[model samples]
Target: MRNLLPFRSAPAPTSKVAALAAVTAVVAVAAGIASAPVAAEHTDAHAVVRDGQNIRYAGLTVRIPAAGEGVQAAAQSTSGDISLTVTRSAEGKLVVKTDDHEHGDEDHGDEAHADEQAEAQAVTADSARPAAAKTCTDRAYALAGWKLPSFAWYYNPAGAPAAIAGTAASAISAGTNALSTACGQKRLGLVPSYAGQTSAAVQVGAAGNCIGNDGRNVIGWRAGSGRWLGMTCTYFKTINGKKTVTGTDTALNTQYKFFTTTANCNNAYDLQSVVLHERGHSLGLNHVSQSANASAVMTPALSTCSAGKRSLGLGDYQGLAALYGTR
Candidate 1:
């Protein structure tokens, strides 16, 4: 079952996309979650702060190998699709850094600048631009074929029920429901699998210590294996006190708590919302920062829960259709 979360007006496209394109061009770009905490509030900027504390990114990062010229070449080729950049370091390791341009602004504070620089340097050290793909839409379909059925649930019971499981069960259920409502029964059984189960080990509190920083909440797979792994966190009492933790990460002690207080550890968020979103990633969908379809689930940021956009929007569906050939 899909849990209903509030929706908000889609925010205007941020410069992060453009930066991502540029960076991805330079090197194949590369490209989570916790809690039953409430859905992340929409923000105009890339970073979101919760409860006057804690911070997170509207987008996630996918890391690529820093070793071997072949791997670097593949990263550069794929980077263009995600609008991210790749860089190689002296050690011949590749780091895929997000194209969050707002952090580059002088007014963002020294912490922000330092963070951006660190990311840039890390990516540059071993990253390379991904090769160009036919189109974002096409890539989505091709990637969808490669993904395994997957789902994410919070570790806290106070959070949405589905997001906590991070299991194929929730993902399959959500996919069936969403596809049924979107394309009817024609595409019912076509839902992919969520393989590649991994976790994004993020650090709570402080600037550089956000979700993406900790490398928790992120997951990926090589061209084959048909498995998709993503980063996930365990529930801890210091975070979610309830005996039944339905979410991925703990409250208060996790990145979600440090970033926004609006997210309730026990309730407030939707499981289907995050599952649907992350499932998109599992299916090869990238963040859409260039489109005007603010209501689209693939839009770069979710500004509100009132928009009733917990599911895939038109652009998202269309992108999928283009990639996989509509069933």
Candidate 2:
């Protein structure tokens, strides 16, 4: 069968108009010299991150993903970006690929837009057919190559609420285990081993925004606001001319409440389900449309107290198989 997932597109070329505007602004600054006050805008979880910024860690730069680049899977509820990966490029920049879901003022018109985008890019039939014959169910998954057979990650539950802190480790591990075993009996060789607790801080900015990759595989909770529920930043580096996975850090937004048990759910998000989805991104899988494949763990959005994502769906499995061959 043909692969039916969207591949990461190349970095967007700098637009001429924007470039010219930037040049004009720079000249104005040069003319003013010391006369004007200079204040650079800081990028945080709450700020809109520009595509190419000099946020550095360990000598590597950052490459933020363009908005609506893949699948057009906007948020079904609550505006937020989901399933983002940060990896090193050939030039040693951390290429960030994200599966984002937005709501509120940045609305995506309607679901029809998402359906239209998905249908336009997807391969529906085995042979060429008229555009009118294509269906929205013909969807695509996104993949990033992983060179390592296994990755070890450490967790820090320092800021997690007491309500579920005790069970956070096991609950989060279930999410990792779900992805490791997503390929079923054919078992893909990819493994996510828990390396116990660590004093290492998760590399998230004060407002819960993802910071530069710090070359440490750590997971923890941080206080944050805005629509984001969680974020995973995967670090990569060039080794022998190949951009390979180096490390990853994940942070859950303590600003939003989470529940581990059914009774205490209280309309909060499921801890395991959210982690499973984030782990999917860490495993090199991108978003599938929530409308098209709502059951898939890789879908861009989730609802409150929903625990169904703790298991992988068919498309989820197919995505894993595509990247790492089934055993």
Candidate 3:
């Protein structure tokens, strides 16, 4: 079937002719899926895929690369139109590193796989800017070609620490709110409303197999000791040369420790701050250059115990406005 879910609002077409073609494309893709032969495995990282395989996540059908051919990180869709990005954070200066393995890169050749390696760095606030210069002077941002009409997300509180068990969920919701109202005094058009808590956890494996087949957008905690403080796996399909995101899963690494409120925050990372960054990704914003956009929430790095990210910088607001327009 077509990878773009019916629930999503497609970008407005310029003419009735273009609209008709879009519908036809969707039907053709669906028919192809129904008539295609079944593969030995579909989207399962544990199993080895030979000659590649087509796996449906939610309503989107994506092609997985064969083993040794490359990896799932480089897999695409049946029409050769899909990609995945696995983002994670590391210790020290709080860098949120991203690994992009697309389907058609000649080097990888649509080999879809997941990589969870965290790049550690000490990102100081003044790393690139003069100590007294304004942070928003450089309004830099990059879009990932996908923007949800609205964000519907769920939270899993199973692995939350006792100290912030009840409060963490609220903080997560607040992080989403930050993005919805990031542009000036208006909403970012891509409204994000809490969909309540879910028992379904993020489906990433220890080796970073991020197959978002559960269909529900979830945020939760997972116990792990590594440089990765958090991870977000976003799935999307390219239609009309535009990316339409199907869903996203974010998992916070409990092993790294976290503080919910700034009052109790010390050396640990700020829970709300991390969610703000991750939620930015959910809203179609890519990581801006740290050297130029260090103050922006979408910057690739954050320092521990810093609560400044709770607010969106100018570049952050500009990017949101550019994608969804301000409400």
Whole-structure CA lDDT of model 3: 0.50
Report lDDT (Cα) of residue 75, candidate 2: 18
Would you list the C-alpha lDDT of every candidate in the order shown? 0.28, 0.50, 0.50
- Candidates 1 and 2, the one with greater TM-score: 2
Collision count of model 3: 17
Greater TM-score among 2 and 3 belongs to 2
Tell me the deviation in Å of residue 132 in model 2.
Answer: 29
Determine which window of 10 residues in candidate 2 has minimal summed lDDT. Answer: 18-27
lDDT of 1 at 246: 17
lDDT of 1 at 192: 43
Q: Which portions of model 1 miss their true places by more than 4 Å?
A: 1-24, 27-97, 100-172, 175-190, 193-267, 303-307
Q: What does candidate 1 score on TM? A: 0.37
Tell me model 1's lDDT, rounded to 2 decimals: 0.28
Q: For model 1, how does the per-residue alpha-carbon lDDT over 1-327 read when each residue is reduced to its tens digit? A: 111111122242222221112122122222211112222212233332121112123332223322231110011111111122223333443322233322222121111121221122222111111122222222111121122223342222222223333442443345324632242213533344333334432222122221323312232211211111122222111112212111222112112211112242342223344445544543444444322223444433322222233455544555555444544
